[model samples]
Target: MPLSRQLVLSLFSIFLALFIGAVWISVSNTKNFIEQQLSSHAQDTATSLGMSITSYIGDKDMPLIETMVNAIFDRGYYSAIVLKDADGKVILERRNPVSLEQVPSWFINMFPLSPPVRVTELNDGWTIAGQLSVQSDPGIGYGQLWDNASDSFQLILLMFLVGLVLVWFLVRMITIPIMALVKQSEAISQQKFDRVELKPKTLELRIIVDAINLMSERLSDLFGRLTNQAERYRDFAYSDELTKVGNRRAFDLAFEQILSDAEHQTSSFLMFVRLSSLNQVNCNIGFLEGDAYIKTVSDLLSEHLNKQDIDFTLYRLNGGDFALIIEGIDEVTCLDLCQQLIDKCNAIEKSEYESGTAQIAAGSFNYGDRKKAILEQVDSALTQANFNPLKWQAVDKLQTVQSNDTWREKIKALLDKDTADFIAQPIKSFSGDEIYQEWFARFPEPDSKQHIPMAELIPATIRLDFSQKLDELLVRCAFTKLSSQSGTVGLNISRLSLLKPSFQHWFVTQLTQLGAQCSHLVLEIPERCLFSDTNNFLSFIVNVQNLGVKITIERFGAQIASVTHLRAIKPDYLKLDGRFTKNIHTEKDNQLFVHSLVDIAHGLNIKVIAVQVETAQEAQTLKDMQVDFVQGFFVGAPIALEC
Candidate 1:
């Protein structure tokens, strides 16, 4: 029962007990008082009647005496009246049998009144003529007592109902603060450090609430500092001092990270824009002007890349070189973007610096291509671009998406059908025991797994607004898997599906039906989902967490506000980005970044998961850093879908 209901019931019980006691006392006193009054009334009637009948008693006019007695009896107050001669012989008697019509039989039995008799001597000329007696009617007294008692009971019942209503209201008023405190405590347990703003008027509750607020503030401050520390570490290690873009180290890791994704499309390229006249500007204009030239080049590249929907990364590879890695861009589009940058930078060089100008080049690289080979190709192209008037060149690169009706119908058919299934990849501990199996939902490709159709279907899922249907299909498969199994399974949910109102309602309802099986399920939410619609995401997190489902932030460490959001969310697992886990043994910068990140997550009691770990060296390095979980091919490739 709710606290308010319990308190109301308890108060009502006490009220009822007191009310019963009060009613019993009132009814007893009224009964006694009525009985005494009836007896006294009978005594007065006997004396007064004896006086009046004295003259008749001496004349021995029996008929007249009877008439007088009958007159008194007819009034209905007395039950009986009797007269006797001075010789002790019965003379005349008048009696009236009295009964109360309004009083109930039950009340008469429960509270029976006793009739009282009074006797007085009747004297005629100094002689005791006869003895007159009168008996009081008990039915009359019973009727009066029943009426008073009935009225009192009705009044008492009305007061009790009103009192109960007041008690319920008061209990709710008192429990509101308590309920707030409970919710606050639950939020804290989930690692959300928001303070409780309600200030209860009760002295003890106010004190408790103040204490909780102080603690929450202190915790929030601590996490804020930790997040700042982590972000500072990332910035200092990866950010270039002059250009403020990612350094060469960041570029290499990002390159490896994108290629590491087996799901990455085959078409990719690396473009390098060089400020060929930096030396001339430094020698003649000024070193400050040379630095200004580099900054301007970096800014232009960043602005262009940020505006595009394409996958790209900006890095200051050297004092004169800016490297950009773009994926899935066709040859024409790549050259167009490169040509635009060269023209824009050359305009600045000719107008202000009067030094040389800019040269741009890009080269295609597919998955599994060597980094050195691709770099050589792009650099060689840049050398040729310097000789060309256009000042831009590129190695062969072209790939276009299939957005025809057949492709759309193909994707729609997959979503509408039950051909999609889940494949499990183990997330292991340092000792190699399976901690969890991250499930991948894949719609069966007609050709092979190597040419998975997600590259085409993914855009369809988003563009066609069918992400919710896809997610629902996978979620149902996951539920079936959980029901038949005893192991933990993790499934990824689309942010789009989570945002849909119908999907959200269905998901929550399904979880309630799943009940205890929820403990074995983990939801892998993408790190990007945290930023798109934060309030809804937080509410979703709280709701699922309350229902005992675990949340994992997948593809972690790609966002700007990662640390702060992670602290606020306090998810059970942070699935580290593949870049951090790639070549970690040989990469000191990545190692330091991963180490610091692990410490931060550990401080909050959240576990870290390093994903896409391919090599043994990478796994060993991550284990040394105390990463709680590792998931990738080296740990175990995804197995066949369970039926």
Candidate 2:
């Protein structure tokens, strides 16, 4: 119960008790006073009548005695008056009728009042003639007593009710500040430390309000400090000290987040960047000049990409290589962005610097599960660019490693039979702590005791339009097994599933069923597939996000143009392309580019993750770059552990 209600009830209870006691005392006193007055009047009337009727009674004049008695009875105060001679014979008798309605029978029965009577001895020349008796009507006294008691009771009840109402109002007013404090406390417990504005006149309430405000201010300051610390920690882990783009770790984390956002939204693109002849520049000109060249490219990309509504982020994956994850864009826009970036890279002029050449290769994919295929496509495009020595080139199609129909059929059969299983690979924090595990689907056949990667099966499922069913089964199995625990698990979605509304609906329904546990599931989509249809994909992602599931973009650096999409679809994490992390430390130019990329991503509060790290030195270098998390062979190889 509210404090006001309790206080009001208590006050009313006390008032009722006191009112009842006072009413009882008043009724008793009034009844006694009325009885005394009636008795006194009856005694005086009888004495006077006895004096007047003495002569008549002595003479045996019964009529005269009766007349005197009748006179007194006619006054209506007495119900009856009677007289008798000394010989005990009745001298005169008179009676008046009493109305039953004037005083109720039940009340009369409960409090029966005897008529007040008085007698006087009449002497005729010093001798007693007869006893003169007089009585007053008890009904009159009863009526007066009832009236007085009723009035008093009514007044007491009215006062008590009014007093109760006043108490209720007063208590509510007094406790308002306390109620506000309680609400504010609840908000603080939820991590929303907003101050209450209620000002209380009560000294105790004022003190409490002041204390609450002080505590809230202190907590807000603490949270600010924590956010700053987290940012600095990110800088240390993912940023390249030299060029300030994403270091390998920063690149990986940012790219992964961007890719995840794209896949979830189904509307983002990627840009894979590589510096040309960084080795030749360092060999001919000095390491310092080579660093300047990398810095030049980073500055150009950052300046052009940092615009309003452009979801673009630059990341230095490692050593002369940088990646940009753009969101909220299509293939044509991404292609244009790539061309612009390449044009800027080509325009750089060197003074007293070694003869160096810069080449740009670009590829765009509609977001899908074919991350490896997208990367290979871009690589093949870059290889084509390398052969031509062109200023700018674009890959016409994203390449896919064709798997045999037999493998596709086997995987489809496993999924249909509900025999598909998953292996989880942990994505670890820099401190070697496990944050979450990426879920990898597998099909184990009877003859082969070992599990076969679902990658071979997933591509065929996409072609067969059965990817959504496979995705649903995998999600159900994973959730059924792992929903009991609290941790993030990654699930890969096929490109074809992105176009199916049923697939989106199923994903959303499953997430809703998980409820609070939905946070444990991380849905990953390939960055290339996101560009297939940006609007529908974005809506689908937003709907699922409303259900509280985490979204991630996979293979984030395949297209240079998709960086524009990042602003619109802010992902939770970005996984950098493995190619950038490979040989990152030895490549100085790539290091500078990766550093710049990390800076861009961190500015937007995105985290970076480096993939495929193979050495302790490489991990340390990534750690120094301020990456949030790392996943590679050096850190921990992907394993087929169950979720």
Candidate 3:
């Protein structure tokens, strides 16, 4: 029961007890008073009548004696008045039956009062002439008693009502602060630091409020520190120490990830740039001047390449060597981009280089094959470029395996036919309880027997501007599956999907059509998507959440700075990127990074889920760090839909 109800019930019981006791005492006293008055009235009237009738009896006036008896009997006070001789024979008598009209039968039975009879001796000048008996009827007494009881009942009921109202008011006052505390407790459970501003007059409650406020402050401070630690840890692991570009480890991971995608196979290129005479420059110009020259070259390469208007990632490979990876470009465009870098490097002149300017070598290779083959080709091209100082060359160029028309036709057919099959991968809590299953749409690969991952297909879908259609299909398939399943299902929705008004309308209509089944749907978006156009993203999240669909952010650790934005629009789940999950148990930095991320997400009331968990040890470490959910091959492989 709620605190308010329990308090009200307790107060009401006390009021009832008091009211019952008061009424019982009042009724008992009223009954006794009415009984005493009736007895005293009968005795006093008989004594007075007997004394007055003595003169008449002494005179032997029978008519006067009868007149006195009749006079007293005419009054309604006495039920019967009789004047008799001493021999027990009646001389004169007057009698009336008792009549109680207003009194109730139950009341009379409960508090019965009978009039007393009194006998008096009438002396005739010194001798007893006759005996007189007088008794009062209980009708008037019962009537008066009933009236008193009725008045008392009305008065007691009035007091009871007034007392009950007062008790209710008091109970409400006591429970108001308690209700506020209850809400505060709920917020705390959700990892929110909501405070109780309601100040209760009760000393004990005031102390409790102070304690809760102190706890909230401490929790906020702790989470702030953890968030800072997470940002620093990511920077230490991925950032290059000198140039601030991604380090070699970061490059290796990103390269492997890109190569894993089957769709970008023939459209990506890797460029190798080497600065010659770096050792001679360091010996002559000192390490500081050499470092400055390297930084200048790195900045100029990035500036000119970005000016070319292409998608690329620049990384410093080693002391005097760097690499650039560009995607979705043809072979000729790739050669033109390498020439641009060579021209920019040749233009640089240093006044304090011992009269020698910087010499740069460049090479380009395809990114579709094995990492070793790609590196070997780029190195071979670089060897050729090193022969000619301050120039670039390409030893190998990636040939177009298939035309864009083929990709467009294939994707269009899938979108038109809506025959794309999806697989479900289960994500479970630390306790092994199934929370939901994440759905992945399968795409046909070049080899007929194999299928490409959703990650690989998404880039092509975005390139073709068919991401909206893809999202619609995914949502449709998810809803169809969820309509019959008893568990929840999560679907990944692209940022492009929300950009289209038609897709938004379709999403709303489908949710409405699904009705209650929509509750089982969870939509996940990349965290990088929220970094841009935050207002619309938040609005979109709110709109979907209002329809009972949950929202989660996948690949959450890409930009650690974005966590600050989570406070305003907290998502239901913050799925840590698989990069952080790689070798987490053995890598101290990865463990710390994940721990801090969890702390930050929890502070914002968002659940932390570790994806790509492939080992028992990794899952155990994640559980120890308080991650709420886990998803990967080790937990369960993706299963095709039965239907």
Candidate 4:
């Protein structure tokens, strides 16, 4: 049933059929010709004998007649010859014993030959003196027929086999191209679009091959384009625009994956970094220059961090901040990594100062309970670095009792009520047109007058290891508020919220519940948070993108080495850190830096937003730089807005 076997069998069958028919025809025709030749010889002999006898009779010579009859009988062509007197008595007869037995009885029966018997009357003058009879010996004819058929049959059998073999070989050659095409087609069906280069010169086969090649070429092109698009989308979802590091969303995702794996398979550690003096540098030299410094630092960190043996990831959490998640590692390994990062940061600071870039400060913390302890350690280290200007220190501060107790009380109260509050900030376009509102966290209080920024409250919850509960509440509150709104609304998530595995399921469920009403929701994350863990971050961003929600990287260009990160994780928008737009007109260097940043972001199809604009001149400068959106005191302060 295979193609090759079927082809061979069909061809051989035809060959055998034709061979048998040809052999039979050849044997039958040969036998008939031999029989005819023997009969003709017998007739000629009989005619000659009669003529001789007639002459003798006319001469009236009895002796001559007898002699002639004897001569005719002596001739061996006839099996029998008889001379009879007037009374019909036989005078002469001849037969050969060896000739009679030469032909087999079975052969004669199978192909019987009947040659006509001839007789001539010999008369003396006008009277008939005697009659001559002659019969041809069928033995010689039968013998020749049998011998020739046997020889011819053997030759025919040999030729038939040879011809069949030749035909089989020819068919195989003919089907080769077709078989190759079939294989290629099957491979294509499996999405393996590999091509065959062989060309069959036969007109029909050539056409088929060319068509297959054309189809393969088209499919390869289609798959290539699709792959490129998917990669671009992936980059946009996970990357920070300015610094190019994994954003907070990416980092949180990676962190959760690592933690889960570690809980099930291996040990892992989280290193949270809070860049000291980054805010000061942005506030002083401007955010554009600040971003350049951050990009440079990120490059340096990545160069040292990308060791083949180490399982580590780096992310840009927010302005002048980053995080690293090292999986299958211990506290000692975590400490060593932190030291290396610190050294890299110091080297970057020195290099920047020499190049007239802004000075930088850095702090790091290693966490076992990454979701809670990582941020707490980083925040504590940052506070220490800020308070003590002379030396960089890793402050090993535990969460305060008051912070822990407050988070407990707050979570219990929220759970009991099952209610939360939301705050909305307007993200205006460059022309002062309202593009959308970004939602931030708000806590419900018995007294309407009491209000606090979600930033402070969320960090407090993270330090208390209650961010998962807080995130669920925030998502519910944010969704409810946005469902009633007419424009886009952005929501912020903490690193702690993202590292929880259940967050993805919970977030997706919330979106499903909101249905079309959630279309306007945009999730905002700090750029620094993405590098906290690479794998989880990449996975998280990809998962979120599948949900059809818009995502943005906040406080973009906060890291010193942002370019490398941007190449890997392309975020949707680069929200220019506010420090850059604070005093744009007076700074020539800042304008150049902003222009360059804008160009880079645009090249990657990422939008740029300038935050904290205060003057028309500043807005005009940003507009010239082609900033997509602007937000600041000059545009409109963060005021209490209706949900």
- Candidate with best TM-score: 1
lDDT of 3 by residue, 464-556 (tens): 667778788777766777878899988877666765567777888888888888789888876766766678667766778889988888877
Q: Candidate 3 versus the native: TM-score?
A: 0.73
Backbone N/Cα/C clashes per model: 0, 75, 0, 38
What candidate 4 gets wrong by more than 4 Å, as runs, is 50-91, 97-133, 137-173, 242-245, 258-265, 274-292, 344-370, 382-643
TM-score of 4: 0.51
Q: Please list the residue runs of candidate 3 whose C-alpha ends up more than 4 Å from where it truly belongs after superposition.
A: 54-75, 78-113, 118-162, 240-248, 257-369, 372-413, 428-436, 443-460, 463-465, 483-488, 498-522, 529-552, 561-573, 599-608, 614-630
Give the worst 10-residue stretch by lDDT in candidate 4. Answer: 357-366
Better of 2 and 3 by lDDT: 3
RMSD of each: 5.4, 10.2, 6.4, 16.6
lDDT of 1 by residue, 15-38 (tens): 999788777777888999998998
Per-residue C-alpha lDDT of model 2 across residues 301-327, encoded as one tens digit per residue: 888886523546678766677766665
Model 1 spans with C-alpha error above 4 angstroms: 47-59, 82-110, 117-133, 150-173, 259-267, 327-350, 353-357, 396-423, 428-436, 439-525, 533-551, 560-573, 582-607, 613-628
- lDDT agreement with native, every candidate: 0.78, 0.68, 0.74, 0.65
Q: TM-score of predicted model 2? A: 0.58
- Candidate number that wins on lDDT, 1 or 2: 1
Model 4 over residues 1-643: C-alpha lDDT tens digits?
Answer: 7677787888778877887788778768987897778777777887787777776543357678667756765665557777676668776566644364766677677788776677877776788877777777777777778888788888988998898778777777668888889898876654457777888768888888999989988976765555444344435655788766677766765564433321122344455555555666677778887777788877777788765235456788888677766543333344555556666666556433432222222222222345565656655655565454433344454223244566567667765666666555577886568877766565665335465334245444544556688778778767766756788887877655665667867777777677776558777776766666767776776667666677787756444224445545566777865434556787664566566667656755678888767789998989988999887666665655564
Candidate 4 lDDT for residue 101: 71
lDDT of 3 at 520: 91
Residue-level lDDT for 455 in candidate 1: 45
